[model samples]
Target: MKPPFPTLIATAAVLTVAVTVAALAQAPDPPQRSAGSPPPAHAFPAPTNLKVLPKNLTGEQVHEIMEKWKIALGTHCNTCHAEDKKNPAPDGRPQLNYADDTKAEKSTARLMYKMVEDINGNYVSMVENSGVPVTCGTCHRGHITPEPFVAPAGNYQNNGPPPAKDGEAPKLPR
Candidate 1:
């Protein structure tokens, strides 16, 4: 006698799950770092170029900050840092020269950083109960260039021009 349809379906599902679990279990373990060994590929070396950023920052700290900026601007290291043709990685990829300021974007980044610092220190601090500090991501929103803001149509309280004078016809938006 043939097995019921539900029994066959259940058996196939169980077999599929078993095969998946076995494959996952057989997968190789990720490489581990050893004591006294060099840092991994993702790790940054000692920072040589200290301009806008504080000189006291360690390589790892700078790396973390740069990673945040990278995500904020939706760009990579190559956007500001230049490629070092002379020193290529073991895999033959050109390494970034973090100190190189040949690119205009790097200077612009420094200026923007200063602006943010000033705004946060001088302006944001003055606001009552304002905990949020401005960041590159605030304006950039994951784009190299910030998108222009378009005001919503029609006059609304607080958003549009002040309430029209009692006698004057309601002024239309220019």
Candidate 2:
């Protein structure tokens, strides 16, 4: 004799759900990031006050771009982005006020970004088939300020010895 219709229907429903869940469980995981590679561009929410970069970037993309800047300038986030002392994050780290322009470094960084953009977009493109773009590292070389001059050796040279004072001998070259 056949089983009751209600019991059969319930059993079928349960089996169907179980089979679907099992199939999903067997599905492969998402791809993992390689060592030293930046996280996926869509990892975080879009940040605010992006004057140079495109405004539609995802949080992850913002972070990755910032990482590039940090490496280029040999600096951390606090170099340009100021920390909000009053409103700390839940993790106890000072929350960065990304939109604030109180720091002079932030202003300078904006100018630097514009300069790099101009160099790459205007100057670099003008060189036929030459795709080399100038960046902060081109000048900074891992330093905050690029050294303008190499240290000179020995004492500074003069045209001739100074005239002798009444009590002093004429200063002569050794």
Candidate 3:
């Protein structure tokens, strides 16, 4: 005789669920970051009543701090976007292409310039009849402030589809 109707229906339902879960478990892992993604931007915590570099410093001391900001602050010249081969902006903001029709409506460029100037004055000291310089340890001393490192949240950058061939589009799962 045939199995009871209720028993057969329950078995089929259970099997279906088990198969679906198993299939899902076997799915591929998500993509990871590509080889050469740039690091996040450099930023500082807004210091309350912050001071500037020491006044009347020599050229060397003045320059030393600027260089230190790069490594200690977790920013390279290309922090914002593409960098020029020779000159690079310490803060990472890209320079606007004069020929381009589009320009950033906001005055971020001015803000960054002011920020760089303000930072330069903070701990700078003057030397006797000479220039001033800053060391990497000047601000970093080991810790990165305002520009602390935060781990990436997800793999957004590397998840795009492979290059299209013969103008055909890729299909997604149903």
Candidate 4:
């Protein structure tokens, strides 16, 4: 006896799906990044210019640091890195000339980096048990230029003398 038309159609559909699944299973896997490898989109060549940052740092390390600073300052690479009009990227966008110091913002960034390093190493470290290190976000807080701090309006009341040190008793207001 011949199989019903619906049975034939079902068999054909099942065969088609099975063949497709087998073909997909035989296909090679997509390329994977090694543990130490950076993503293909962010693959940076070895850095040539070393100035304010540590000379020993790798391109990836520099990229990571710059990424942090970019986020902290609510800016982009173009803010500090000049565009290389001479060389365009594969997509025809102007490539960033990271080593170029022509931009004033780049110089200012270097100066700011040095200042932060000094603050962290010289000032913050001086206080015993001080664990917090100042970073770009400490002041910038996601702004390119930090907004000026405004003190809350209030009348100072002489509640009492300042709290005493370790051994001294609190003094009353005169």
Candidate 5:
């Protein structure tokens, strides 16, 4: 049976409103900017307290290296950087003190960087002829902390070395 004309019009109006509302909801918002505010296009500031990295590195080079560390550790700028309480930015966003080593994580990262450098220089050079050096990604794998190794479940006693081979005199150390 067909509904009355008024009823059909009301149903159509409701459907139209629903469709319009849905479309508006899904539409992307227009870019917003303040009349007096400019976009952040300034170059990154030069590094200050470069304890682990070379002191002679250019500010731009330091910035690029930091960017790589950010990617390798799957972290943001604030992960190791503390807010610049002394020289805050005008925009009210936390300005970072890139040189600050107060944060424990930052210190730990410094140690890790040194360890990686030593491994690549001293160890990898000795063992591998590939010429490709080890990097933070060798172990971190885009994680802040590499996964720990754990032995599989077993009934071995004392966690001692495996039994000596037969007739090997138990391989006792003098």
Candidate 6:
């Protein structure tokens, strides 16, 4: 059953117009958020605030913070604390033979080291020192650099009043 030529042309025009209108009405929009994603939060704008733990403490507590600092430094511990069966990786992070006093400023490895004064003239022990050096937090505020994402805690605006905008109409439904 073929329609007349004029009728068929009219139907095709209507169909094309309908398709165009539908496409415009249902046009895709940019993404607002991803699936399985958490809401955004405000982060600390600055680096962490470093706190120096008091030196007068039990050996266990001091060692605990030191261990924490070690973990905070992440993967760099091996370059310093690794067991040296032979030469101390001479050309590695901190040069093993660089006249002893140049440990901090010479290499790109200060992020992984704590400034510790020698405890004894005879031996290198921790607790006997007159003054201790800076730990990892001495540079990094909390131990972790570029701190983790912190979610904003609460919604500041409550259901008190409607938001006001300039040049707007007032609705009686309020």
Best by TM-score: 1
lDDT of each: 0.83, 0.76, 0.46, 0.83, 0.75, 0.44
TM-score of each: 0.68, 0.60, 0.20, 0.66, 0.59, 0.21
TM-score (C-alpha, index-matched) for candidate 4: 0.66
lDDT of 6 by residue, 39-134 (tens): 435211221222233535444444455467556555343333334444545465432331233333324333233233222322344446535444
Q: Give the C-alpha miss distance for residue 5 in model 6, angstroms.
A: 99
lDDT of model 1 at position 78: 98
State the lDDT of candidate 5 residue by residue for 30-90, as single tens digits: 2222223444355545667888899887676787788888898888888988888988788
lDDT of 4 by residue, 1-174 (tens): 885998999999999889767655664322323333334655667778878899987777788899999999999999999999999999997899998889999999999999999999999999999999999999999999998986454522334455689988876666
Clashes of 6: 2
Q: What are the RMSD figures for all models against the true structure?
A: 13.9, 11.3, 30.2, 11.7, 14.6, 29.1
Residue 91 in model 1: shift from native, Å?
1.7
After superposition of all CA atoms, the RMSD between model 3 and the true structure is 30.2
Q: Predictions ranked by TM-score, top down?
A: 1, 4, 2, 5, 6, 3
TM-score of 6: 0.21
lDDT of 3 by residue, 32-75 (tens): 22323343243222223212445554344444554555566565
Per-residue error for 132 in candidate 5, Å, reads 2.9
| Model 5 RMSD, rounded to 1 decimal | 14.6
Off by over 4 Å in 4: 1-39, 154-174
**Over the stretch 1-174, how does candidate 1's per-residue lDDT look in tens digits?**
885998999999999889766655664321323333445656656778788889888777888899999999999999999998899988998888888889999999999999999999999989999899999999999999999986666635437555689898876655
- Model 4, backbone clash pairs (residues 3+ apart or across chains), number: 0
CA shift at 66, candidate 6, in angstroms? 3.0
Model 5 scores a C-alpha lDDT of 0.75
Residue-level lDDT for 35 in candidate 2? 33
Better of 1 and 5 by lDDT: 1
